[model samples]
Target: MRATLDFLLNEWLDVAALTRRPRFADHSSETFASVLDMSERLAATEFAPLNRLVDTQEPHFDGERVNLPRETHEALAKYAESGMLAATQDEDMGGMQLPFVVEMAASAFFYKASIGISSYAVLTTANANLLMVHGTERQKQVFAAPQLSGRWFGTMCLSEPQAGSSLSDIATRAVPDGGGFEDDALGPRYRLSGNKMWISGGDHEITENIVHLVLAKIPGPDGKLVPGTRGISLFIVPKMRVDAEGALTGERNDVTLAGLNHKLGNRGTTNCLLNFGEHGGAIGYRVGAPGEGLRCMFHMMNEARIRIGLGATALGMAGYEASVEYANTRSQGRRVGTSGKDAGAPPIAIVGHADVRRMLLAQKAYGEGALALALYSARLVDEQHTGDSAAAKDAERLLELLTPIAKSWPSEWCLEANSLAIQVHGGYGYTRDFAVEQHWRDNRLNMIHEGTHGVQALDLLGRKVPMEGGAALRLLLARIEDTVEKACTQEALREPATRLAAAVARLEQATQACAACSPPEAALSNAVPYLQGFGHVVLAWLWLDIAVRLDGRTDALARGKQFAMRYFFAHELPKVDAWFSVVASNDPTCLQVSADCF
Candidate 1:
């Protein structure tokens, strides 16, 4: 099923041809294509073969002992050996130093092969990035180096039983141990005591050591939990202590894997309940300044959010591909005109039916657009970090503004694509004999992983869009305008470009209307709607970009591109106008209702 879809999308879309473009002229696209090629090959040959085995034989813990599937371990080893583990690391650290765009492209393959295993690698990369950004020289040498080398694994411990999204509610504490600190030491180590929940890859036999970046509150000079996020500090707590010689000969830290969580999907990775300071106290060293835990964690969180979106997009792509293949091969009934004339003849493939084609096309439109959106956001991240000052600032602003949309929109919409995939498979999709059901289950988790859609919507409409005088939003609009102007020169893309321009204008007006509302809550009340509206506009712009690139071409692949772009503009872009109407009206029906009305 996947093979047929891959041939159609990868071949017909000319994704490989796009990769072969000149490196100097389109370095970002070239590098991204290379990474995609590597990942796709690895996923097809290595990870895909073990996905079902790992899923069936999930990691298990026997209170004091934990064991992972042999295939899972071997796959991790293969990934590390293949240099995938270091794709985003620095060249000096034995990494490819690929841009974020390339990393995202690489990640899509893993996501399609096995989301659970990909999550482990994603978390490890994000955790290493945090250490590289904030860790002291000694800390980076001891921890970050090993992690990037895949010698050690990493996890972020932020959630506790008492606290989920609200960090102020966190009860974990880090107390000063009063140990004498050497001049060359990183910091005076502290005693960590608390429990963390929903810690992915928290306990596994995949690596020798696990580095946990925990968020804990330390007593301030004034003492009372220190008010808010300022009281929280980030700590580097390892599973085992290491000596000055970099030997693991010291005592094991008092951290314990309390239990394993039973989840609906993503079972290949261990989601653990971790207890720190069980026996005495788990020794931890501070990563950054005191009262800066949330800030450091946000760095990891932001990156994870974007990666999560990418993962979701990939799953959607796989699901859509599966459905398209199934539709092309599975015979059910004849076409409407031939139903009576060919009653005794063999049924036609489901793809011949109008309704089935609708479903497949919808999936294509949603999933493909989502991939472009995520990749574009990743490219922006690369530009933000590696580009010159002016470009960097612009990329940073645009990324900040689009982060919520990238994370939330795909999380919600792509799950819908997965659902459509299941419907396309009929009874087979419901059984374990087919992988579509698993795709549905796996994709469902993404909607809640980084942040729920509601939470992201609040962050986008309430904070990101309007904060700092909406500079980010304004910058994003200017870039879309620039794209529109460039697209205008291409004769074939003029109409779609004009439609996209109108959508952008509508989005801007809605933004201004919401920004001008009397109370902030009024603006936030329709945030979800606003996000939907803005997402459509962004996707329209992406389609126009693709159309403009394919303009003046006569090849088969170019025609396919033209078809997809025109289909998107004709069928999907109009939805933005409907959303625009809702947002522009600033309806209060939803907000006016009382909680008890239900």
Candidate 2:
């Protein structure tokens, strides 16, 4: 249940060299542990109890308004009052200046408790972060302040009715306002007219204001629509207009709720179709330069990607917990090879069976592995921000390369772990009687949340893999090799070391094949397989790294780590073989299939 001890203390402390930095002079491991303790306590008390309630009683939307449970507002207020909303920001910005890794670790507790309710906080933090990075000084004071204090919520409006993932096809338009009405601090205002669909946390009464980070294109000098994302620009369109002092001017922006999008899971969070500038035009403040909305929004998109993975991991963790508790307490059939006497004997806990243990072990490998990857990615963010120039550059490149995997891998596989969690509970798991069912439903959205698996695969194989002439890929391999080398030194890890080394070799070959294959169409046909195989190799490396860390220990935790490594090596690692083969061969079967064949 507490893999954080091994990952945060043992893995990150050494890898990030936290103690050596003056920026962290006032902080220590104990400080970070206290955060975890507080988060665990708050999650157990506030969020965990409401997980099922929110799932069943979901937010209700009438034609005029959306209403959420009182408990949702209370829990979120407590979270904001706890100062976690600004945990990773600058002190001047009302943050504690904590390391990103610690912030992420603390967040996992709440995510595991209830992702549906946690959605509000996630969007607020990401919104504030984007504003800090790209917003003007006055923008932060006006928009980011209320969000950081949890008085206001935020949503990134990118997808439209017709443009699902294709930003280039977006039809939303923002025109410079020629009217005299304006604020002095929030910068130049524009009239934004568009409809944004699939906007989570888009419409809510829980906060005083909702900051909508809109993506719309500004027409060219010729007054014609720009063809693609190149014309897109980012805008800050609030539900209510605010003055320079961050007070509502009693005037509502033209942003209105078109309708609610009922979903299969995460029902506690309101997803809405937002109509911007319907009356005339919603007054919007530009966040960055024109034609840079996609580039600017990537700040939030990348953060959301990693957060999606962590949320998926947390859902898997929650499912695993429910399943394990059931397995330990529920009496089932006796051992398989029992006699007539044993047939009449008392049944044992289901966890005593081999198959159930396998299921639990698989969950452990995936859930914990995902946590490690998410935290590692968080550490990379910290490094990119504070490390020396060279280290920051390296971290930047590696972060880019790993971001797609960090987002997609857990989303795909951890959701699989949720399925196995259901399997561990058998028929009970399939029904609403068990929490695993909700967890499964909730986690399914993650694979399609930040980006679909297909989208991530294209990003990974088509873009990230070939960036900087493969320097980041080489760095990733070197890091894995370092782990493999250390693993080879121990007698217990030698076998895994060799096995993982072979996997790395195969992955290298697959990468080469991806780069060398001719024709963009042929080369990218099997990008999904490439992504899966690459993800497995990365997880294998992390598992081996954890195993090597436990080389001399003989405690139960060490044994668990060793067993998980064994399970990963024996069960999960080989999955890359078939996937890698498809990628290496540039298999065209799926691509070549005709629509009529179906």
Candidate 3:
């Protein structure tokens, strides 16, 4: 992992130069190295040891209180003490002020160790970030500060019982308090009355308070609910109200934990049904202008999407590591060509088999390539914020285009890697004794949450690809071509360079073909295939990028990277041809099928 991280930071991204910048002056390679070390050690010892324990002993709501394992609380406290919760915040805000890239790298360790426990921090960081950007000064001072300090946790309460992912249909009402409420550090308050569903980290006793960023609609002049997302607004409704000076008041908000959601995986994280105002109403304070909830929530959503990708990548890496260890030590059948009559023949390690190597290589390609993409996206976020005006603008555009892929590609592909890890373990992998089974189970949820595969495909094809006259897509294509051109200059990378170039060309052609389709719906019918093909080509480009840098490496790790690069170009990139063909054909089979056909 250090090798992978160092290659990204020192060789590819030049973290030293990034640190020397005025904003990151306090950071250095040595310091970031120490951060990574601490993260990995804490993950292995403190978080990872409790992963299975928490999984088996899921959180329970005893009607009045939600009970979690003591280990879960201890793990969170350790994470809070690490100073990483505020790693990327401004120094003046009681943070270490580390770069976003380094912070994400550290986060991956915890995700790999235990996603359920780490989710509290993820939600808190994203919540704090959102508030810092849009919350009022008083709101930031009262809510965001404690979240960064890990004194409180946060949740994005959007989906409701009747309306899932359809914010327009949300029936939650935030009626402005007409002097019945007293104002504190947070601004004017309201009475929020509605139920929120599937809220992760929604209610827990691990922290002093649970900050619920609830989405609700205020009544119009006629006292009727405003329709659609345009009328929706964000509110800061905590489990318990706090005074202006960050001290908790004895007053408990009307927010109630209705029940706990029993999930297929990630059971360690409590997903809950929260009633915002079962009583008169939950005292809520507006974050931004009324009816601007969706726009504000997108900030947190986008960050969570990228974090989901990193989480999936980490889980995939964990499975890959476990399986590789098993392969290296587990002896299996003899070489294929060896005779059965040769009693002297010895069993070979699973890694010695060609097919097993293929599986390992595939895992390596997906896990590491996805990691690189996530980190690259984080770096883009940095550039968007801190780079010069033009660079920042370009980075913003490119990031918008890549965000869907960053979220979906890893969720789709790394889960495949986990399956391959299970395959490498054969029968043993499916059993509880092996960790790969749980890894697969844990990763399965990522594909569905945040957004489904179909949703992301539509976002990538129907929206991002066509947005702004395709400027973002064109810039990305140009960048890929530049990488292709660089790879062609090297003798060792010429073949892969050619292969990747061809695949990218197919992707480009397919994209244009779909874009040019007369009716948009017809083109969108093939979105899933288009996204798959595009992701493969993107991974191909990334492989070539790594291959070009690996020109003079003689070490085994470097050689492994070279092998995975070659494997992807040869074995994986070609699959894009068929996928792109499906996209280019504009097949309407799925769209044309009748509902009765099922």
lDDT of 1 by residue, 1-598 (tens): 2332343334333333433333223444455456667778888887888777777888888766678888887888878877777776777877776656666767778888888787888898899899889988788878788888888899999988877777788878888877464233745588899999889999987888888999999987675567677789999889888765446765778899988988888888899999999877887888888888999998999899988887887788888888988898899987666345467778999999888877777777777778877877877777777667998898888888889888887887788888889899998889888787887787787878667777788888888888789889888778788879988898776788888888888888888888778776777788888888888888887767766665577876556556666777888789888877777778777888999999
- Residue-wise C-alpha lDDT for candidate 3, range 337-414, written one tens digit per residue: 654434468988989888999999999999999998999899999899888899999999989998888898899889
Task: For residues 295-335, write the lDDT of model 2, one tens digit per residue.
Answer: 88999999999999999999988888887899999999887
- RMSD per candidate (Å) reads 3.7, 1.6, 1.6
How well does candidate 1 match the true structure in TM-score terms?
A: 0.91
Worst 10 residues of 1 by lDDT: 16-25
Residue 244 Cα positional deviation in candidate 3, in Å, after optimal superposition: 3.3
Candidate 1 residue 415 C-alpha distance from true site, Å:
1.3
Residue 496 error for model 2, in Å?
Answer: 1.2
TM-score against native, each model:
0.91, 0.97, 0.97
Whole-model lDDT for model 1 versus the true structure? 0.79
Rank the candidate models, highest lDDT first.
Answer: 3, 2, 1
Model 2 ranges with Cα > 4 A deviation: 3-7, 10-12, 179-184, 337-341
Q: In model 1, where do residues sit more than 4 Å from their true spots?
A: 1-35, 179-184, 338-341, 490-492
